[model samples]
Target: MQFVILCKDKPDGLDLRMATRQVHLDYLKDVGGANLLGAGPFLDDQDRPTGSMLIVEFPSEAEARSFAQNDPYAKAGLFVDVEIRRWRWGVKPPAA
Candidate 1:
């Protein structure tokens, strides 16, 4: 199944997010691999990242939660909230 992981950064967390970004990317690449459908940061009006959104495939919600909890940004305490939910791609899904 596909899951969406929405992460909200803590207030004043830009510095920590930047510092941990590379490691976080690496972790996503390492673990998410083909299951990582898409991922990116959520930007504010000033075009600064304030959070993240990731869509990934996992057999169960438990595995998806585990993936979210193990993210470098999560480990570094950059997020104030993280929400994971089942997702449906209603438009322009990749060609099979």
Candidate 2:
């Protein structure tokens, strides 16, 4: 099953986010990386990253929680809030 991880950064956390970005990317490149489908940061009104979202496949919610808990950003306490939910793939749109 696919899981969606939504995370909101702590206030004044941009520096931490920038510093830990590569480490987070590296985490996704390591073990349990295969489940990774896609990930991106959420932008604020000023176009600054304020949060992040990652979609990954996992056999259970336990695994999904582990993935989120182990992320570099999470380890560094960059997120103020994190939500994990099972995601169902929707019908794809036809080509234009």
Candidate 3:
């Protein structure tokens, strides 16, 4: 199944997020296929990352939750809140 993980970072998280970005990227690389689409920082007028959004594929919600719980960003206390929702894919057909 596919899941969408929405994470909002705590205020003043930019520094920490930047500091840990490489490790977080490495972790994502290790779990690459699980992630279908991902992006970070909700962005503001200045176009800076304020939060994160991810869409991933997993066997179950438990698996999705586990991935979120073990994320380097999450472990580093980057997210003030994280929400996971099962996704229904294919609203729009892939471009041919």
Question: lDDT for each of the candidates?
Answer: 0.96, 0.91, 0.83
Q: Higher-lDDT candidate among 2 and 3?
A: 2
Report the C-alpha displacement of residue 24, candidate 1, in angstroms: 0.5
Better candidate number, 1 or 3, judged by TM-score? 1
If the candidates were sorted by their TM-score against the true structure, best first, what order would they fall in? Answer: 1, 2, 3
Q: Clash pairs of candidate 1?
A: none
Which pairs, if any, clash in model 2? none
Cα RMSDs, all models: 0.7, 2.9, 2.0
lDDT of 1 by residue, 15-43 (tens): 99999999999999999898899999999
lDDT: which is higher, 1 or 2? Answer: 1
Task: Please provide, for model 3 over 1-96, each residue's C-alpha lDDT reduced to its tens digit, 9 standing for 90 to 100.
Answer: 888899999999999999989988888778755455555558978988888887787889998899888889999999999999998767772343
Question: In model 1, what is the error at residue 42, expressed in angstroms?
Answer: 0.5
Q: In lDDT terms, how accurate is model 2?
A: 0.91
